[model samples]
Target: MIVAFSVTPLGVGEEVGEYVADAVRVVRASGLANRTDAMFTTLEGEWDEVMDVVKRAVEAVEARSPRVSFILKADIRPGVTDGITSKVETVERHLAEG
Candidate 1:
């Protein structure tokens, strides 16, 4: 499955890069198949492991701020792996063919 999520620390002013980085750090340290774009960090793994990483990431931000806003979207296909890169690669392949 592939899960894309974002963590925003609220009531902490306009610049929240540091807090966002805290969450991203947790995701990176997990060693999961992942990519962080401008808006979301996408992770590919089994259900438990992926959710655990997301939970830890939110906690990382929660530690710094009283309120945290987390948004998550998941493609929970049972028999899929490496969708993090493969999904994008598939789209690129199609575009190239055209």
Candidate 2:
């Protein structure tokens, strides 16, 4: 299964990329998944593996900063997952169905 998830803020800024990097590092270190890049990443594993990545990402950006007000959205999917971009597509499909 592929699950795509992301950690984003209210506004776009330099921190946006930082948060992604921080979270990706945690995921790679967890030994549950691999880190592809700072902004984009791909972790191959089961549901637990994917969830672990998302949890780490949440911890990485649970602060109230000037740019990062809060988590704008968090989406997960199956089959194959990337980062924010693919996750957004998953979201769009759900919205369209609704």
Candidate 3:
């Protein structure tokens, strides 16, 4: 499964990069397959392991602000591995062929 999410700390003025970095740190340290883009951080693993990381990441942000905004999207296909890079590569291959 691949889970892509973003964590934003509310009421933290105009800049929340530091708080968002806290969440990304948690994701990076989890030893899971992951990627961080400008908009979201994505990780792939079993449901329990993935959710555990996400939970801790949200908590990291929660500690900094009274309110938090989280957005998540998941591609929960079983029996699939490395969908993180493979899925994107597949799309790129199609585009190159066109």
TM-score (all chains, Cα) for each model? 0.96, 0.49, 0.97
lDDT of 3 by residue, 1-98 (tens): 89999999999899999999999999999999999999999999999999999999999999999899999999999999999999999999999999
When summed lDDT is taken over every stretch of 10 residues in candidate 3, the lowest stretch is: 11-20
Instruction: Give lDDT tens digits, candidate 2, residues 8-95.
Output: 6545555466666676677678765454544445555567766766676667765533344322222344565444355568899999
Residue 38 miss distance in model 2 (angstroms): 7.3
Tens-place lDDT digits, model 1, residues 25-44: 99999999899999999998
Off by over 4 Å in 1: none
Please report the TM-score between candidate 1 and the true structure.
0.96
- After superposition, the stretches of candidate 2 with alpha carbons farther than 4 Å from their true spots are 11-15, 35-39, 64-98
* Each prediction's whole-model lDDT (CA): 0.94, 0.57, 0.97
Cα RMSD, each candidate: 0.7, 8.2, 0.6
Report the number of clashing residue pairs per model.
Answer: 0, 2, 0
Judge candidate 1 at residue 42 and give its lDDT: 95
In model 3, what is the error at residue 94, expressed in angstroms?
A: 0.7
Estimate the lDDT of model 2: 0.57
Error of 1 at 96 (Å): 1.0
